[model samples]
Target: MGDTRGISGIGDADDIGDMGGIGDAGQVGDTGLSDGPGQAGDAGGADDAARAEDAGRADGSSGGETLGGRDALLARAVRLRESGHREEARTLLLTLSERCPDDAEVAYQTAWVHDTLGLEAEALPHYVRAIQLPGLSDDDRRGALLGLGSTYRILGKYPEAVATLRDASAEYPDDGALRAFLAMALYNTGRSRDAMEILLHQLATTSQDPEIARYRPAIEHYATDLDATV
Candidate 1:
């Protein structure tokens, strides 16, 4: 539901399909992955905001190190982002990332905010740091992977996108969103057949449309062997 303007070489939202269900929420199949040419970097929507609010409300009584009410600041940033005050959120997150350079959550949120603002180039390092630093939750790690790879693609870094997406797909095999983005990256890299194969396989197994369902077996049969004879 965010601004979905297209970048050069990347299709608009209608062309790329909605990627709101990529990571942290659940499997891509569970969310009904859509098809398209572009990838949405907004991985988790309300779930992210809710989680940040919950964390902010925590008393931090646990033995974990509290960097001067880091949770509260992170929650504030999430609120700003969810509320569509992205410029304010980005500025705050930049400061937070500097103050809490070692905080995975801060780095990840910083990257996400940057991506939402169409600053994918600025987001790269933060996404990498979030993934590299300890303390990132498993769900967030998955989201970061998808975000990083999709960012790479948007920036015209095709090889990097392919590599990052492939690894992400391998790690989260059941995530159809990963495969969908991976397919896009593959197509950009001139592997149209491979991309179509991935899309076909996903459609065959996941689609609920009556026509696709009726031809599921045939689609599956041709998924990998697109050039096969009858």
Candidate 2:
């Protein structure tokens, strides 16, 4: 399955700051606090402020600059992936993960690249690492959980898959996509009744969503077959 999470444009304040002189400080002030040839001093102050701002922007000091070397590398890897250079992107992400073993974003992006490359075995540990990252966004954590569960399901680890998907569903209880994935995992694990229940719940809650409606036939088919089996 593709990444269910939507990708938004990165809005690094550093990049904006790098554009130079976008702030009012670079413009001459009319405060009239000084009298003797104050224009030169004001111009000099503006130049200094502009230079400092440029330097800060180049060093990525704005917006708290919390992302470390590994995160930067992973971000570059993501760019490569977006450009359709999958192999190079995978290599960059893997290198970043190796370089910064404790960086969660590095590991997370590595796993994402592995999944894109169909390297399920290599992806599982990274997904687990991503979920364990402290203060990860709920959306990111849920995505990692779903990815892990889906990978396990593909590998025939049905019990693990079900447990992982269940955990993800609990974390994102209102997520129709997570619930749908959980239902599929349940069905694959021989818990057809549970799958039917999940499908029915999804149908009830998301009847108006065109994407959910598209799955109705398969859900109904599964529900009917489950009823017959029981």
Candidate 3:
């Protein structure tokens, strides 16, 4: 569930199937998206582990109602997903989305479910809706961006992915994950200069984080020359 954008969750061009959610379990405004489907790629937002470890809440920032019933249902769904009961979780989320179609959180969760299940085609529109909706939390918003942007990359919609990831970066300037995804999109779209620049920026800024720092050399290599890569 993911990225600088999920505005709410998001990931890389290579499957980015590494699905997951953000925050502690049962936390307020959680995207409630998670539980890995054992897919091939490691590209996705927050991740199944994040969703399993963290609970989701209503879209508090977006003004979606944070009623007790909704919270309970969301928590249950999260548990189900975490426990590898993805279909059950998806079923619950679908019901929730139907009951509250305009609820950005619900839409976001629905998108997450589809994304987790490898239904990138199905997940796209819901991610768009969640992102467009006003009452989303920053995490959810970024996650939506992550989901939407990542899905765009998966569909080979490089321009759309670039635009979406750039929009996400504008909002989440410091998000390394989003930047990496953006780099891939840019590279794919023949915007290697922009891609390398962003990658360099990410390396410079995220050097303190071990996970991100490891990508520095690769980024440097990628940035130094685009034609060679092509």
Question: RMSD of each candidate?
Answer: 13.6, 12.2, 11.9
Pull out the clashing pairs in model 1: 16-38
Count clashes in each candidate, considering only residues at least 3 apart in sequence or on different chains.
1, 0, 45
Best by TM-score: 1
Q: Give the TM-score of candidate 1.
A: 0.71
Model 2 lDDT, residue 72, Cα: 33
Model 2 earns a TM-score of 0.66
Q: Write the residue-wise lDDT of candidate 2 on 129-223 in tens digits.
A: 87787645656666778788888888788889899889888878887777888888999978888888888867845698787688877766665
Q: Rate the local accuracy (lDDT) of all candidates.
A: 0.67, 0.61, 0.63
Give lDDT tens digits, candidate 1, residues 84-121: 77876676677668667998888888898899888899
lDDT string for model 3 (67-153, tens) is: 433444455555455556667767767766765778788788778878888888888988998888878887777778878898999
Q: In model 3, state the lDDT of residue 188.
A: 94
By lDDT rank, best first, the candidates go 1, 3, 2
Tell me which residue pairs clash in candidate 2.
Answer: none
| Order of models, best TM-score first | 1, 2, 3
